[model samples]
Target: MAVASVTYLTRLAGYIALRNRTLSPRIVEVMEAAPGCVLISVIAPHFVSDRPADLAALAITLFAATRLPLLATVVIGVCAAGLP
Candidate 1:
């Protein structure tokens, strides 16, 4: 098999293993990190000259309030982020 196919298979196996152990602390950490990173990225003046801190703050607040698992929020955020 090609290198890419091998890598994909390895990732798939890892995912299957991880899903079997849902709600792990490591996964929670990843879930919180993505929004914080996105919040920071959106706040950085260099990225947006206007510095929409208000919007970023609101988004982060809502994300925090959802109380959903990191994987769910991150997946939703990623999909929503992609749409626009």
Candidate 2:
């Protein structure tokens, strides 16, 4: 219960803080890129560890991301990761 309250209050505080503010276009563009940046941060270590499967998967996913839908990219990535 205490954890939940803290989580809720923190989120609420952020919402209240941003609710009245108007952000610039550049900030909004950066915000849009934030998820991909975070995802790369999380995945970079795995890529740097010299794992062939992960490298293959990332390559396949990158290619699919450019040519296919999100769901297809994910499916191809998972399949690539399972490759031996």
The residue-level lDDT of candidate 2 at 40 comes to: 66
Per-residue error for 79 in candidate 1, Å, reads: 0.8
Against the true structure, candidate 2 reaches a TM-score of: 0.61
Tens-place lDDT digits, model 1, residues 1-84: 464465556556656767766687887677546545644654354344354654554465457549878776667655544442
lDDT of 2 at 51: 74
TM-score of each: 0.29, 0.61
The runs of at least 3 residues in candidate 1 whose Cα sits more than 4 Å from the true structure, single-residue gaps closed, are: 1-61
lDDT per residue as tens, model 2, 1-84: 664566556556655777788988887676556556656665678767687777778888889999999898889887887888
C-alpha positional error of residue 1 in candidate 2 after TM-score superposition, expressed in Å = 21
Which number leads on lDDT? 2
lDDT of each: 0.57, 0.74
Cα deviation of 10 in candidate 1 (Å)? Answer: 23
